[model samples]
Target: MHHARSLTALLLTVLTLLAASACASTTPGTGSVPAASEDGAFPVTMTHRFGTTTIEARPQRVVTVGFNDQDFALAVGVEPVGVREFLGYPAPDRPWAPEGVRGKQLPTVGSQDLDLEAIAKLEPDLILGINSYIDDEAYGLLSGIAPTVAQTADYPEGATPWDKQTEQTGQALGRSEQATKIIAETRAAFDAAIAEHPEFEGKRAVFLLGSSAAGFYNLGADDYRTGWLTELGFDVDAKGGEISYEKLDTLDRDVLLGEGIAEADFKRDLVQQLTVVKEGRYVGLGAFDDDFAAALGFNSPLSLPFLLDIAVPRLAAATDGDPATTPAPYLG
Candidate 1:
């Protein structure tokens, strides 16, 4: 009996030891050791107009004073802790912001003016901006908060193509490869759409925006929005013609006018003056559901994909016969 009791006690001790060993071997929450890449030095260096910026390890927290920068960061799979307030013109809602970032919960730092004090409160490891809005004075202020980058292209400070801007910003965030992939994928998607709808080939189109004060600005060939249109194989209007703030007597060739204008007035004044308008070739594009026109003004990384999606269908409709059904022939 004594021998049997001693044996049972030994068995219980062995079982306890085994259970404790198993529990230790299995990680508590994740079930595996944390990856080296997840918790190691991932240094990246970026050159911008403000100068060289080096970030050690991936930034866990980010802030953006510009919409485009915020968009790029989201595309590369990072959500900014803070971003500029959703300006009203680009869709009453921020359709382009990441699914998780919406409503008043994300915190807004006022407009593009960049609320430095508000941003400082967030304690972000990185901050990003673009175009003339981020001047040397702003840069000094932003850098004091965190690493900041600005647009570097020579083509009028604010007019860099979306793809180029994305590539540059992605590099700064240590996600150049991912950026390249996104761009290539987006281009491929566009090319496929163009292929599916051959009517988009060689179609002439225009982008028009009207201000409450400044009549209307006709987007020229050099404009970033035009570059997007041209990518889908549209023949963009020449910027050589002067933009008139005064009421126009005529609308001309292959005009793609903005919505909100009285169609009858446009027909009588602007439409009758242009030869194309007389021929009934004018196409009127309304405010896109995505607020693409307003988004373009901000020119952020978040807006590029939205721009492509919006332009593709609109261009297809303007050039193609039945936007809902049959594809139309090219209108060059």
Candidate 2:
């Protein structure tokens, strides 16, 4: 649900196009294979939205142009030379970055305002924009600088699932087997969490970001934040089509998650009309909390473990269907 408003707009525009075409089968394209070395690595080709980019050998100098691409790279044992700077927040550090990268001085690439000159100066052998908005022009430029990998062409812009990004990233870096293991372990963690919280099974849930002016906004099915809930065995209810402000009261589900809702807005008559709110099944993720926002934006292997710790118990308490019980405190 990172940038939920912008993400929803992109999804609506591409939903019909995606439905018409069978892009689900459009896995990342693979090009020519490199001669395997004793390590069983190299010359790998990674297919993405832009086109097939071949990495002749294992890349030593890497740069990540996407918001969380650095996290993905670090999780797989590579330290990027440069990473995209997170806007709005004062600092650029990610809470879930591995210990090795926590204090390292990684140069910054602009997200909203890209610094092509800075990226060029880094002289990276591999450029990862896998989870970012890399247009044809940017791709051409970045590819010229180094082999560039953009988001999956099949999925809508900015909507590439995190797991797909992670897998593709690993492939590009000649670490497919390691990436697969990381993904399996993350999935196993989710499975274990589900096994522990039997109450979350088949429970209807909705994730929302609320404000006084916009009311409550649903992170639609396409958003990874909601998708993660579905992974944890919750039946997530996503807004299929545009639900106007007036019709917000009609949103029905058992477990309601509200992010960034002010206490005053919670007291509003219209907001209180929702069934979940009336039943005291709403879990409030604090507006000022940085960790919650970071989890929504960066659902990577390193971050998912932290997210599971917070999300499972709150979801369990919310869906228990008991008005007398309240969820544990939002630890994040």
Candidate 3:
């Protein structure tokens, strides 16, 4: 299946809309033709929640307005001129993505506080906001400067599947073949890990992150934070709520996985005595523990391998069903 049937429909609809005279079915990520040449790839059009945007030619200067869209662009080798900063974390220079910006000075475009003036100054031909929260008004304003694309209706905001995001970015950049390769490689790594850890299946698990005075919170189904864990074949039980320290016992499961809770945070008697913890099956990481924390946010094709490299080993050690095996030596 070199081309996805659904993506083919999208390409056909767009091509028919523009009345493209003749072409066979397109490569899924590559638009209009099978492995379309840079010139043949456009006037390619992509439909999103904001509407259809037709790239008349291959984009020379693109800007990514979504917090996570830059990773998708970087995955496909399109170095965005400007990238929206996500959660105060530096982009391009991020630990999870070493080859993304590669020391090119990419200006920040403000994540939630999008600076339209800065974006317009960059003079981008294509604006990618596929993982963003650009409303109708903002989309119109961005479109005024250049063709602007917001998130598609198919995916919930901030929770687009990594593969789909990569595909659209590839189509937008006319680099679909490269995007397909990256996706296959990333999935293969996860698949290999799944094969190695058959014990992970038929088990219960929960993922929690960070803490507050009120309680520590777990992510919901739509949150990208838990997507990888779910894919690894665990019945990832996302509670979708916060639990106070006193009620931490309820998070008990075969394996407790999470990020941002320090080793000290688990020192409490209530946490230490939990069945999962006593069995040495908890793998929690500090916010600044390593690059895994930031990679969790990106969750793109480029960042997936970085996450798996660190996570799979730790999780495997924890879930080996042996109490003597310590998941992380630092996590007391």
Q: How high a TM-score does candidate 3 get?
A: 0.84
lDDT of each: 0.57, 0.70, 0.73
Q: 1-332, model 2: which lDDT tens digit per residue?
A: 12333333444333344343333333221221122311456687777777798888777678898877877877676777788875354323557676756666678866665666666555567889877676675676667667888887677777777678778878887767767888888888898998888888787777777565656667777776677888877776554344445777666677878777778877778768878888878887766456866766677887787777777777777777688787765745
User: Which 10 residues in a row give candidate 2 its minimum summed lDDT?
Assistant: 29-38
Q: Model 1, which residues run further than 4 Å from truth?
A: 1-41, 89-93, 102-104, 211-215, 237-242, 245-251, 255-268, 272-275, 278-280, 287-290, 295-310, 320-332
Q: What is the lDDT of residue 216 in candidate 3?
A: 70
Clashing pairs for predicted structure model 1, backbone only? 68-300, 68-301, 71-302, 249-269, 250-270, 251-270, 251-271, 320-328, 321-328
Tens digit of lDDT per residue, candidate 3, span 6-92? 233344343343233223332222111222336667788899997899888877767898888888887777777778887666555
Candidate 2 residue pairs in backbone clash: 34-43, 49-153
Count of backbone clashes for each model?
A: 9, 2, 0
The C-alpha TM-scores of every prediction are: 0.71, 0.83, 0.84
lDDT of 1 by residue, 1-332 (tens): 01233333344443454445445532221211112223333476667677877777556557777655666666655666777754444322577765655543556665635555566566666776754356665666567657776777556656777787777656666667667777887677667877877876776665555423434566777766567667767677666244553544332434364533444545444445655445444445444333655555545546656655655554555454532432222221
